[model samples]
Target: MNISYKWLKEYVDFELSPQEVCEALTSEGLEVGSLEEHQAIKGGLRGLVIGKVETCEAHPNSDHLHVCTVDLGQGELQQIVCGAPNVAAGQKVVVATVGCKLYDGDKEFVIKKSKLRGVESNGMICAEDEIGVGTDHSGIIVLPESAKVGMPAAEYYHVESDYLIEVDITPNRSDACSHYGVARDLYAWLVRHGMKTSLHRPGCEAFKVDNHDLDIAVEVEDNKKCPRYCAVTLKGCEVKESPAWLQERLQIIGLRPINNIVDITNYIMFAYGQPLHCFDADMIKGNKVIVKSLPDGTPFVTLDGVEHKLSHEDIVICNEEEPMCIAGVFGGKGSGTYENTTNVLFESAYFNPTSIRKSARRHGLNTDASFRFERGIDPNGQIYALKQAAILARELAGGTVSMEIK
Candidate 1:
């Protein structure tokens, strides 16, 4: 469980630095495994922008090089020999002036007045990865056309450093894997130490649910395998990339952004200690959802694009025709939601811990959901979690609740 400094600040008010917070957590019971500093590579590289491309001529010495004159926002023009093919006139780009530290591929170098290919080059143009935004170094970073000629790139990018505290949680402390769980512990500690503890959770009252012709039919063939199941169907969802803030939050937790619909489910799971799943309604074949033990010699493909063979003891989520997902394990790729999906069936349920453990071990796959279920989270809170996810999905993805499964 890696807790970021920015994330921890949202739950409690403390004047301690990240290192101090790690020490506090370690002294309390949650052991800190490691500490990582999140720093940008280009130190002191700011306020330099592209003025104008004076002349771009093919290099006389090298075949792939282009000798050009770039204005450094100041009146003087600096000649730079660059090998990037995308160099053009009137483009706003980063320029590493003298005395600035530049990092490229694990090697850090200080910019100085130097000559390249017999041309006096004062600085070098930068890419996105060079400035530490992303890992794309295929070409020079092309800024937005509206970017000012002499503006600080850091200010425009809103780059901030953070620290990641890797937490080693014991088996009994499975609840601490989520942000809300950690917040609970921190809240207890803060109240005990006379510190401020007031964290706002998203309200779920404005959401409305109606019973209509559309209804989710769930049949658990083996009650011993699945203890509880809760599901909701949402309509009018627009699946797309998540917002930057949401993406950053997930990245802080070491998860890459997928989409708004999927990220909301994942975010809710991390925030409230419940695992949720969103299924494509249009691809569900029939309106029925069945939770039961797999038949003998059944096969399915999970979300990770891997084929899995299911035994009779394994539990699965099936539609009228075939299995759509492995219950408490993974969703199948065939019935998954895509960019074009408009309707979705969200599931937040509790499975028998022993059954989930056996299925995970048999399939040789241990997912986050399986890990939590195997360790025993709150089993009776699936309905509340379903309502929470439904409200968030409606709020973020512009969806309507059609029906709910209980």
Candidate 2:
């Protein structure tokens, strides 16, 4: 389990350093494999700041290069040569000033005064991947306009040297597999040690989601394998880039930001410790889902585009026409959402632990959902998680809840 210090802050307001938290968790039975601070890489990010592109023009000597003058809120504007195709005037970007060192994996890169095809560059403009915050190396990371030009890039990008605690959770410790689970346990340990806590306990137990009465169908063929399955149907939802706050939450946790439809599911799972999957409603054949056991040798394509042959014991969530997902595992490609998808259906359920575990191992596909399911989750609490996803879908994706499925 990789738990981010910043993510834990969202749940608990403890001022303990990452190392301290790791120590506390270790003392409480959760083994910490290692603790690493983001700043430790590349000897730390210093002399990097949020910058505004004052002007951007094509390089005279190279067609693919752009000469950019950036305002760092200082007396002099710094010139940078950028090869990103997205650089534009009036954009907020990362400016790695001279003498700053950035790392890509173990390789060290130093920003300095140099000429890029005859253009004298004072510093280097950076992307998320360039500085290690994310994998988006397509272009320079554009900060929100509210970012102060002179703010430290680490602060602006939230690199605050946050630590990721790599924990070794035993399979029997299913509840501690997620960040919230870890926080909850750590909070307990803190209280037991006579430390004060401002942490709100994980609230999904009584979490309320407004019911939108519409129409959907769900059938669990084997009640023993799938105790309960809930699907939240949405209509008129707009799948677009998530707002900055939502995107930041996922990005800081090292999850790639997709469209709002996908990101919301990821965010809810990231925060609530309940794994959820969203399917494009329009793509769901007959607007009905059936949770059942498929025949052995059934071929199905998961969202990753990998075709897996199903065993007779495999549990699947099928639409009227075909299997939409390997229950408590991954979604199928046929019903996945895309940018143009306006309606969606999110599934939250509890699957038999041993059943999911064997199926996951049989197919050589272990996912976050499978891991949690195989270890067992709060079966009675899944409806609440389903509703939370419903509420978020309405708020973030401009969707109206159409119905509840069981």
The best candidate in terms of TM-score: 1
Off by over 4 Å in 1: 39-97, 103-109, 115-157, 210-214
Per-model TM-score, in order, reads: 0.76, 0.74
lDDT on C-alpha atoms for all candidate structures: 0.77, 0.81
Model 1: how far residue 272 lies from native, Å: 2.4
Backbone collision count in every prediction? 0, 0
Where's the lowest-lDDT run of ten residues in candidate 2? 201-210
Per-residue CA lDDT of model 2 for 1-406, tens digit only, reads 7777877877776768788999988988899999876543345568888899999999999989999999998979989999998999999988899999877677887787999898899998888878877788889888888889889876665555667888898877877777777888888887887887867634433323345654677778899998888887888888899997787667656788989888877776767668888888887778678889888899999889999999889899888878888888778887778988987888888889999999898888888788888888877767767777777778788788777445
Residue 212's lDDT in candidate 2: 60
Clashes of 2: 0
| Residue 398 in candidate 2, Cα distance off native in Å | 1.2
lDDT of 1 at 153: 63
**lDDT (10s digit) by residue, model 1, range 268-288:** 777777888889988777788
Query: Pairs clashing in candidate 1?
Result: none
Error of 2 at 234 (Å): 1.0
